[model samples]
Target: MQSVAKIRLADALVKIMEKEGIKYIFGHPGEQILPVYQALRKSSIKHVLMRHEQSAAHAADGYARASLQPSVCIASGGPGALNMTMGVATAYKDSVPLLIITGDVSSNLKGENVFQNIDVNAVFKPITLQSHLIDDPDQGIEIIKKTFQSLKTGKTGPIHLNIPRDILQKEINPSLLDESVEINIKTHWKDINQVKRLLRKSEKPLLLVGAGVLWSHAAGDVKSFAEQHQIPVATTYPARGVIRENHPLSLGLLGTRGTQRANYAGKNSDLILAIGCRLSERTQKGLGNAPIIQVNLDKTVLKGNINIQADVKEFMEKISPTSTKNTEKWLHELQSYNKVHKIRTNYDKTPLKPQMAIKEILDGIGSSILVNDAGSHTTWITLLMEVSEPSSLIFSGGFGPMGYGIPAAIGVSLARPDKNVVVVVGDGGFQMTSQEMATICELGLPIMICLINNQSLGIIRQWQELYYGGAFQVKLENPDFVKLATAYHLKAKMVDSPSEVLAAVENGLKLNKPLLIEIKVDKNEDIPLPK
Candidate 1:
């Protein structure tokens, strides 16, 4: 610690965050967090105040997914922190790098009948990669460093740090940062013999890639291996744009709504080389109930169809992309499968399907950054949207959180100011965090947000229709997003017919400010997940 003019402890907290390169945070101010608010007012860290804590948490999750960078969120104690727990869990499960900062009852007041005091650490422990209480103000720097290191370690996820009201005002020395040593993380390696035997022996091989591919920016390496060996590729929803959809070996997406070619190959492959993906039902076809060689950083993934637990990068690095090998038989067969059904863009002719509009956005945007919120709207987007680059598609595959798309688009735009960022969110999910439009407006960060106004939580409706004989409740009704967008002083256009979509999206993108394009999607559109 060094001496300086007396500064508010809260200001010091914000300063530490700013020094770590956090551009913005999504949060809701509350009484327990009043001191944080007071300090934030004077600090350089910009916060997006949301209507609910969950939305803020999801937005942070979204931000992390979009930029491959850590995103932050703050909430009041008790119900406020409780409200954000699921979203935090979503990020943790999905392996998103997020920092969730929650306010708590004064440290001195804990267990003394204090208002807004809850065991946030206990509740967050199961979800977060790490959870800590800032018991000593002087230890703030150390806690933050370790928190970030833990959250950013291989196969990163969310971490939680609770700052009590009284603790936020304690001043501490900055010298701790000098004494902190950054540690290197070694990606776990696999048995060379096992991996070598699998690659050398397999005749029918298929490569399934996911968001982890882009997270590590190994699309080039994966592509190199595939091209060298002529391995056909099938992507999961979260990994839609990891490689060009039209590439000779790329099968776009795999699952119910995925291309028929991809699914057929999954069913036939003797060796399913799944990398950076958990092989979710939509992608794995329930693990194909077959032999699968899954490569992921998480050891828990081994419980499923996974045969090995080595980091994808580590394994790929060890195995030379065998120019000596050929997968011609497998590639030819899968291509034949791709040719079987002749995948069609039927939504173009269908009556106002949300997927049709999604196609239009993809068609017009080419390869711009895309963020898909969790829900049915995501289903339509993932199945229909086309992208040309790796890491271009960002979605909550494991940490499925609604209201994540829009705020994450803000982060995308901030991270890559030159590129256009688009967010696709369902009406039910949109309204949950639509208040963030204020944040978008305040920053004047241009982003095009498409709200699929289906008037219901489409995914839950689909689930009810499937297993519960359509016993849908608490999934109905949606607010007018145009009105909500107007209140936030952001430009918004409502599209009810197919004819109005392209022009509205174009106008929205052209605007120099935040814009929302709301499409009156059919509530009856029972879209299914892509295979």
Candidate 2:
């Protein structure tokens, strides 16, 4: 009888990951995960060692956003797994597809209260779409297979898998990992005829695109459809670049912090064709009682006058409106409104205005990917920056985590080495994951860190000033960021005036190396919201 080929469970797991086309795994190493780490040494998959497990998850999240492919992150048991909760939750909230793996104690030690033993699945179950533990080495391959299959189907989000330490060393049949599962996704097409009828009857119809459009890789189709039928386009914050913001029909972002014209269009349109948008409270606040036709793969988010549970790209492709009502008058009115209510960024003040700083950064970056952390800086960028391509502008929109810029930029840089990456972060958010500077330097990525130092949690301070009558506990005594960046062997500079803003950014980008430019702006400067 012919003997079947045997392989270590850890080796088989790594081989499975390789077969799944996972190029990188962002993570930190631990004693419990050493066997898998050993297996990775022989595989073609590159492991990026993040400064913290949270950063690893965040990095993987950014990679998925940039690459438009499922990304992976790993952590050890107990504390390591716990640290990944926030990042994983952020991915979940944004619907980014990420596969998170964690190493746990041996199966025999379960229920004995051993060292570094905690219920990882329980901790992660609420945050991830699926959380499973692989106790049986023989079933490990099947579990991983199901995990990847789940990640690729339905509404994309994070999935967690915990493998016991002892199980990693056991032997398994290597042949079991060879065959790939054929996932047949059943695409739904229910309300297309109604949607087409609505479009034909409506005069001032608007297309409200969201992150779902980008995730489905339907931006081109969405844009083409908008152009084919004379419809204007507006995107949610995370979907800023779905259609080039400079397009005449593009209404930019649509929400409280969005462009005035977009908000106005959302409120005034006769019919709204919302594609892949969750229509969150912020987005819905601007959109008036205009009847909406929402199309999304996740039926749970389908709350509209007419809801269709279908893939956004597929829907866009199939719903071909043969003829539509001429909207030239409405388009002209929107164009006029866009000109009159343009967000201004031409402040040449002594201490830089955040708006002006954002404008300069956008101009200096010039088509590179711009990733912003959660803070008042996010508001500034959303207001002034215009992205020209899908996935070029990234944000922690849903969970709104601080300290996501640097690590996420690391992931974007690694995912697209051909394009330079810029991080626009506030001083408060920068301190949260600044240690990743070492990782950037080690990798020698050409990422520019634009630290907007307002010396406080700018957004919270703004809230307090507007709503609570004062700022308290929001102020921060910041460190010398220039010296700190220098300590990490990054090219560093400080600019406090508008005259120096563009020059500094241009200089940093010209260097084509890891750089940090700390822009000292007015701490009391509030984000300019539409009146």
Candidate 3:
């Protein structure tokens, strides 16, 4: 008979993380989570100590978005755990997979008004796919397995495992746990005959994709299907990179900040094939009553006129090529809209128009991972920036949270060392998580952040100007960002004119260390919206 080795529950937890192929754990250590921190020190898995618990979850969210794999984050109970809710809710809304382990007060202290103790399981229930409270040490590993299983199957989202301090410190037998369970989610492959029939009958067909396509690794499939049938494609915010923006058949993004051609194409199409997208109001508003052939792994979201419940990749794999009705005139009409509604990105303003600066920067960096923080700048970047590859642009789409760009850029830089990472953030949003510059400097990550300094909460101020009287508290007083970056041991520069934009970007790209290039723009300038 084989003998089972005894180990601390915290140590056993690390073993499971290792088995799951997790490379790094991003979080902060606390009094309650000391055991896991102690175990992490002796294990090979690297732990990134974040300054704020919220940024830890954002970093993990970024890793999952970039890698298309679930990432783990840890938080101490009470305030620490509560701070992580926004990140978890953001992931859930966007269908990003994450496993968050929170450490609570000791089991004996439950219901005794102990420090760092709350009904965590109840608080996280609405935001997670599954929330498990491990009350017994013997069943802790089992709960971990079940959490991962839930993450692997069905529509991917965040999951939480609450471990009391005593349970994390208790001893457990390692050999008794199962280590070889399947991790891939099973798919119910649907027939594509009806889809083919719809394709043949339609005169103008358009395809809309979202983050689900990126999560399932179906970018190539999406591209192939579009090209094979000569159908035009557009994507939501999170799916910006799934279809290369430079493709001739691409309509760019569609939403409030979308291009005019994309919106026109989506509104006029006779038949719509929405794949892996939830078609939220942001993507579906004002879209005419067109018959939609929706394909998704989650049946709840497959309520289109023609619904197909299947994996997007598998559906594309099994699809048979067939002749379709002519769409050349429709394509030409969309192309004409592009010319009539072209956005002015070549302004020669002295204080440099934000769009012109973005254009110059894009010209300098051909194709790289772009991260955008939530603000007026997000609208400009998503509408103007060209994506040349899939999974190359990360956005806080569902939650639209500020302070996501800097930390997310760090995570992407760490995950893809071979590629360059660029961040575009407004002055207001940049200040929210600028402290992550310390983390970037500590890790020596190669990322270039283009801070758009408008010196106000640009978007909210715009809202105030249009609706209600002009509100105060919108203007901001910021530090000298260049000096701040220099203080953090990073190369920095400030651009005040259009002529200086490209050169600054070129210089930032040459450095092997972190860089922050601040572009000063007019605070009163508004992001151009589609007419």
Q: Highest lDDT: which candidate?
A: 2
For model 3, the superposed segments whose C-alpha errors exceed 4 Å read 179-193, 321-333, 336-340, 347-349
> What overall lDDT, based on C-alpha atoms, would model 1 receive against the true structure?
0.74
**lDDT, candidate 3, 1-531, per-residue tens:** 967778999998998888788898989888888899999988888898777888888889988888888899999998989988877888888888899999999988987887667898899999887888898877778778766776655577899999988999889877736644444454554547878888889888898887778777888988988888889999888888787788999988886677778888888999998999887878886366889888888766666887777778877786636678888888888888884346688767686787788778777876678888898887677666788787788888888888888877877777788888999988888888898898988998889999999889988888888796985799999999999989988899898897688998877788867999999988888876544
Q: What are the runs in model 2 whose C-alpha is more than 4 Å off?
A: 180-187, 339-344, 347-349, 529-531
Question: Model 1: residues >4 Å from true position, as ranges?
Answer: 1-16, 31-45, 138-140, 182-190, 286-291, 304-310, 321-324, 339-353, 457-480, 528-531
The sequence of per-residue lDDT tens digits that candidate 1 reaches over residues 1-531 is 956555545776677677778887888888777877887787677777766787787768666766777889999899999999877887877777888888888898887776777788999999987789887876776777777666555567788889888888776655554556474554444455666677788887778887777666677888888887778888887777676888998887877567777777777777777888876756656235456777777666654343556566666776655433567777777777655433244354435777677766666654568888878767666556666776578776775667778766766676677777888888777776677787788888888888887778777877787888875574655666788789988888787766567777766666656788888866787775433
TM-score of 2: 0.95
Residue 361 deviation, candidate 2, in Å?
1.7
Predicted structure 1: clash tally? 12
lDDT (CA) for every model shown? 0.74, 0.88, 0.83
- After the best TM-score superposition of candidate 1, give how far the Cα of residue 502 lies from its true spot, in angstroms: 1.7
| lDDT digits (tens) for residues 381-477 of candidate 2 | 7766778998999888989999999999999998998888999999999999999999999999999999999989888887888899899998899
Better of 1 and 3 by TM-score: 3
| Candidate ranking (lDDT, best to worst) | 2, 3, 1
